[model samples]
Target: MKIQIRLVLILFNSCLCLYGQENPRLDSLLNVLKTQKDDTLKVLTLEELFLEEFYTDPTKAKKYIEEGLELSKKLNFPNGEGFANYYLGAGYYQTIGKNDSARYYINEALDIFKRIKHEEYIIKMTNALGVVEYTSGNYQKAIEYYNIGINYSRKNRHWDNLANRIGNKSLAYIKKGDYNLGVKYSIESLKLFDSLNSKSNTLQLKIHTATAAVRVGYAEMGLKNYEKALEYFERALGIYDGIDDIVHMGHTYSDIGNVNLELGNYDSAIENYMKALDIAKKKKIPIMRGHVLINLGKTYIKKGDYEKALYILKEGLPFNEQFGTKDNLSLNFNQLGNAYLKNNDENQALVYYNKSIALADSINAAEILSDVSLNRAELYYDIRQYRNAYLDQKRYQFLNDSIFNSKKSQQIEELRTIYDTEKKEQQIALQEKEITVLEQQAEISALQKILLGIGLLLSLIGIYAIRQKMKRNMLEKEKVDAELEFKKKELTTHALNLARKNETLENLKSKAQELKDKENMGRGYNQLIRTINFDLQDDNNWENFSRYFEEVHKDFNSNVKTKYPQVTSNELRLLALLKMNLSSKAIANILNISPEGIKKARYRLRKKLDLSTEDSLQDLVLSL
Candidate 1:
């Protein structure tokens, strides 16, 4: 037993040593290649260097992938072209958080894979594509690709690959809200993984299972699974201790942080998030760094540290936007709005809320939109903007109803598809048995084969029908693509125009603000008198009035300046009163003048400004 324990300790030590050696060698090779002059050698070395760095140092991995892309394009090698694009896509997906662009390049590689007929490349790209789709909320499309990938792997007798594909398929199904099916496939995948006795895969399977359970809202089950996941993660961590598998380690910690967060263990969540952030910063992985920042912001928000939450989230928003994730941007904005509200900055809260709504609208992020609208309605209610609150509440209600109905419809559709598939499989099996019997009978009586000939003709007709259907489907896809491209261009143009208009409006607002500031500099007594006299300037104020008030409120400068080429400063006060929508009594009270005197001043101002009843004196002063 002592010898066995010592051997186990040695094995563990050896694993750590191997993991530690990986980073320094990768760093040294990367530095050497950075200064290399030969293009071919540089390209070749960079590709290998990027793959080696991907797990430990994704930011450096991205640099190498970019360099490889440029070299591959220069060399004009199709194989290298495919590889470079694939690497660049994965690099962006993994490091820059640009999954859409990652999907694009991965699809490009998939097209090349078909031309090259490389099964390994095809399966890998397919699995990657599935991941992209799954992340994008297209769970059905992801499952379709994963199924194909699984079939290919199985046909090639690649058990490890088949298990991985099955695991991915299970994740997609779970995301699609098919928990039973997800569990079924997950179990199958785990069984295969255990049979293979692959330690790496065993750890991965535990993580996947925990994640799926958590996503499906089975939190207790999730936590149970996560215990196993934690055991494996720690095992891996121990093996990789003192080694800089910073990128993978960071992601692992992030995963742990998320699980802990869901379980309401904020302290543990913070611990893991801080660890992830430290590694991400040291590795210079901007995307993962941004992710950790957002997660940290959430923890702060939950802890009621509104100021710190806002600071962290605002800093992280630009990174998320630069990475082209409108969804993440919307989340950040929503959080900011909430933080501002918590800090009692209602105006700022409204602005951020509106921004979040706009981004959510742009991305069709239904959950964000619903939550924002509800929050906005509550804010409006607090401000006594009842009508606006009612409108927002109604909108929120409508969205909630739609989401509920859509989810129900999707569930019904899923059930129907499952039922149809099972029925069709049974029919196909029975039909195959009938065909075998018919063939046996036909072979025994070879003279009467007209039915078999007719069946063959019918099969040909069916094949032709299938071909026609496929052709129609292809045409439909092309049409959809064209329409989508045109709409995308239109939206781009609209957004540009809207941005320009907003800029103009902001400038106008700034000018109005400057005028208000100037008014604040002096004129203290005059401003006070204007406010007081506005209420007394009606018909009742005619009996009591001051002569100086009569002088100041006698004429309207806006009118006089237009009619006589210049107006006195006293007349400007009367004109400003007219612009303020005050009654004659209010004007008299403000200027210590009689109502008749205020009326006289108003008439003089109107006449001086060359105003008419059709256009109010208020509009005239506003234009000036």
Candidate 2:
């Protein structure tokens, strides 16, 4: 059994290694595939070849998987078709980073598995769903699917599958910041692998154990247990070294560097990070290179080498922007800010900090938000912007607390779910025992059984009725939301129309004045100019327009006035026009002022609002 498993592992790794640069195995595989006459064998070979390039060359992997899928469909091989779809989903997710497409393909594969009642593949595909959710940062949903997969694996006594699911759960916990629980699950997975008696599969078990160790190390790092983290990382490194896993070895080196940096072993950290960076570059791993660059740049910042830090960080920006993970991008931006700040370039620091915050907010990355907010608050304090400093400090505290509480809540909910499931299972067993005993009772009457059946039917009918009511309520709520959105659009359109008409009247008055000036001493032209000027300056028309504008943008004028009480009425009119997104020339024509005058008014408005040069007056007005 152990020898057979070892051969399987060798074959799998050999297939993957075929895609490695300078490998002769790829040409050998292609030669063999070309000579193969059996369609089934050809499809199987294509699947193996596709997995080889799945991560390293996704475009090529996709072509191979599509060919395999087409062949399987033509051969009416449902199992082959399901596997092909699964790999296609995995390729999209891990290589191309398209979670939606991944989810769709995985679901399609899942349907096929379910239709064929393939329990083992169903469990694997369910675990794949967890992986998709994990990549999407839906930690709680990922945990749910992982739990489901684990339960199924356990019931089927599939120890290897169970270990993999547990390892995945550990990763999800670590990502969610429940370091303690993550460590617990990692240990549990290691124990399970240790208990397996497949001597022939010892290498496979060792690989699993090594992965679990790395997870534990990450959890320890998250928990700030640097010593424990180093121990686990070293252990994992040893295992990977034994297997000649250069990729994982590179990752472990970076992990060690992070711990060393945190412990203030700056020289050791730099050395380790440089080693990792060298490996990444040699292997052409863009993501690893980006991450190692960030770590190196941050280490330089800590060492007070601000210029070096900035150079390194800026070099990493394009790589990170192109292919790094979102978290890595946030870290790069934040590190750039720190480097700039250390160099006494406060303006550049602020720009990078804002960029970091924007990216973090878009991804709802609470951990990144906590770190960036604290750094931003300190930057604000250093620049003597006390209000902004205070606001950012508050934001940091809020996010820190939220992250802490969310992790705690998730852990508690997981435990509660497990407890509930176990308790319900126990109750089900007891009920089964009771039913067995009741079935042996000959004294039970036929009338009692009939009444019991009627009671169950009535209960099911009540459940159906409640479901119907819920469906109606949901439809009603959706209808109301649609109506509200339509009304909002209608109001905005009406306000814009009124602004346009007001601008047209002002333009007409300007044209009439020009005509009167060109044709001097003409009583009829003079009278026409007077009429146009009266219409343009008409207070009633202004009042009517203001009323309509306020209705569309409720309390906008009042909000601005409340915020900047000293703003003059002319500035208020300027604000209104700005809110409509009108150009400077159009606003000047509408307000009967020159463009230069409008510019001066905008400057004054900025002063009254205490806005920096970076702030857009138009955006502020529109937001209000």
lDDT, candidate 2, at 585: 71
Worst ten in a row by lDDT for model 1: 1-10
Candidate 1, residue 507: the lDDT equals: 34
Query: For candidate 1, what is the TM-score?
Result: 0.56
The TM-scores, one per candidate, come to 0.56, 0.62
Task: Please list the residue runs of candidate 2 whose C-alpha ends up more than 4 Å from where it truly belongs after superposition.
Answer: 1-24, 407-624
Taking the tens digit of each residue's C-alpha lDDT, what string does model 2 give over 539-576?
76567557756756778888988988898898898888
Model 2, CA-based lDDT: 0.73
Say what the RMSD of model 2 is.
17.1
- Model 1 error, position 117 (Å): 3.5
